[model samples]
Target: MHLIITDAWLARSRAIHLSGTRLLLVGVLASVFLMLMTVSVYHWLVVAGAGEGGGRLGRFVLNDEMAQRERFMRENLDAMARKVGEMQARLLQLDSLGERVSGLAGVSAIKAPPPAGQGGALIASRSLTVQELDALLRELNIAAEQRSDWMTMVESRLLDEKIRKSMVPTQLPTATGVLGSPFGWRIDPLTGRSALHTGMDFQAAQGEAIVAAAGGVVVTQEYHAEYGQMLEIDHGNGLVSRYAHASRVWVKKGDLVRRGQKIAEVGTTGRSTGPHLHFEVLVQGVPQNPEKFLVAGRDLPNTRSVATKSP
Candidate 1:
């Protein structure tokens, strides 16, 4: 084949030719030489223009792709920054609301320590570090916890106050009953001397119903020499109320009674001059002006007006 190709090329002109093996070797050497030339060209280009790529694709497509990716990243970063700012504002709002609620709940002032990290501004506004933000969150949590605690305290106090408010005999038990002697220092009806009056005397017709002023457990339902056919109720909050001079007692010890419940009938018994109810409000076992707590001012409404509340 080489002799035939050489003779054919010699006939045509100076068409050099190789045998099969030499053709293979020359092809390999030519491939190696082309690879080296390519590498040298690449290095020359890269060294001459450092930032510009060696044999890079045209700038149009690659630059457009890079610009779009950068724009997308910038937009995403901007949105994330906005969200962070909104969350920070929300945290501030929560702090304000917590303060207001705490005030209404009668919570004491919190002794918060000073913040660290200079806590200086972000664009003229005090910026909080991650640590400072966490600290603020902790303080808010503590404030919220204290608010709940204060609400619980208020609830307990309100319960007791409501009980006390209800317990005092604020109105006449029987519609027919009217007060004869008021509570205070008064001339004794029998002795005619300035004596401390312990309770109010509600004069009424005999057999008329005597109603309880509040819901409570009956502590005493027995006859007494001074207050015959007496009924005493233990309303919680260190309060006790008595209904005396009852003709017939309907409640006994430990019996639960509600406001306006008929516990007895009016009677002229013991020290009473006629058919009447002797009502008393005792605080810590000592009698006080029942009128001060009953039929009083805005602290409590009239017994007829059940709208007044306490805490």
Candidate 2:
């Protein structure tokens, strides 16, 4: 590079010369000065303006976005907490219901352990975390399911027991009567010889109604050589009841009958010597003492040992 200087009054001129290295150094210095000025102006515009609230626009926008996100999260947590509380209340109701049903079913219910006591000074109250709420919900669900299953089992057991009791011969066959000839060994009325009497005789008026001892299907309804005008009911489990010396038969073979239903009238149709109902209970064709079953739920007088001349 070269620069020329002229003096007007002295009429003299001077020339100055520069090398490549010096010219390059001058260019670098000018670039550095421009960069410094640019940096100073930017600092005055941004940093100084922030102190006067004009530069706070970006900060305000960022804070608003963060606040919205926090609000959404808090709302969801509150909803979850409320749900957990509802589930807990429902579980308590279920527990109470189960206990009542268990009592009606005549069974003991398995109880859960009581919760631990909780008490503290009210220092602070904080919202539950997602993890804590989820745990509570899971526990309540399991408890509810277990209680439901237990109640179902109890119901099934109760139903089965009821059916079994209905099939047993526990009802008296006659409405009004006194025990005439008791079951067991006795003298035959006609032959005057020792014999084994297989049934109990109930002394009632002629045309008195005779009901069934239990619920069953009538299997035999015909006249017999010894037990004339007889009707046999076949209960389940190979148990049967026979009513002998009936005056009139109301049910026939294959007809279903319920306990305490009228089926015949009392009379001496066969080898009986008087109008009396001869009721007999049998298991697999083996005769059982009718007194054992008839005595239940009744306030009948004790059978007298005095022998009577009857079938």
Candidate 3:
């Protein structure tokens, strides 16, 4: 690049030549000066509010934007507060359900904590800031999660125990009958001598239906010398029930029977004075007190040994 300058100020023409490097330097300096002037003018305009409707419009716009931001923040805080309140209510409901389940399963009931103290001097309160509300929400969320997990475990255990109890034989064999003899020492009807009766007897009409005490599989169905037509049921968990002196047997060996299902008919087919059903409960091949399981199932009080005569 080249540049030429001519001056005719005193009747004499003068010429000057510039190199490419010098010309480039001058152009760069001019550009820098223009940039600085532009920056200074912009700064002055903003400070003096010269282009924003005499400064009132600029201040109004800024204030409006700030107000909008504050409103949005307040709305978010209110929503969070409502969510926390709902969680607290749900936690209380879970606690109540847990208490009822514990009582039904015979577990030790846990007392609910006492109500929090609320007595204090009444005073004006300020709105909570965002940071404070956030901290409170986090704490409440953790507590709720722990309680939910605990309640779920308790509910599962209660359900499992209830199912297991249903499969055990604890109910009476005869639907309606009077207790003929207790399960302890008794006089044999045929021999007329003191004998240890291993089973409890129920007096019912001949051919009356005899139901199973619990859900189980029939293990034996045959005639016996002492207990004519007898049927044995093998309940799971080493428990079994025997029904003897049946006039007729409705179930065969290996047949599945549910609780309260008719399995035989009461009669005096064996050594007995009258029509009756001999019901016995055995645990692990050993005879156990049937009355114990009966009382446990019915949740009845342990009183004196007495007969229950059905009306």
Which candidate should be chosen as best, given TM-score against the real structure?
A: 3
Candidate 2 residues 150-237, lDDT tens each? 9889989889876666666777777654778889999999999999999998888899999888889999999998899999999989
Number of the predicted model whose lDDT against the real structure is largest: 2
Model 1 regions more than 4 Å off? 1-106, 109-178, 184-196, 204-209, 213-216, 236-239, 258-262, 271-273, 283-285, 295-298, 301-311
Candidate 2 lands at a TM-score of: 0.61
Among residues 3 or more apart in sequence or in different chains, the pairs in candidate 3 whose N, CA or C atoms overlap within 3 Å are none
Which residue pairs show backbone clashes in model 2? none
Per residue, candidate 1 scores C-alpha lDDT tens digits across 1-311 of 24333456556634455779988998899999999998877555544443456425335445788999977866765565566667657655655665665565555534445557675556664334456555655765676676566556756766766666566566445554466777789998789899988987776789989888666899988889988889889877778889998989988999998877889988988887788788888989999776665556225444542222121
Instruction: Order the candidate numbers by TM-score, best to worst.
Output: 3, 2, 1
RMSD of each: 13.3, 17.6, 11.5
Clashing residue pairs in candidate 1 are none
Model 3 whole-model lDDT (C-alpha atoms): 0.79
Q: Give the range where candidate 2 is weakest over 10 consecutive residues by summed lDDT.
A: 300-309
Writing each residue's lDDT as its tens digit, candidate 3 over 56-115 gives: 665676689999999998888888777777877877787788678777766654455687
RMSD of 1: 13.3
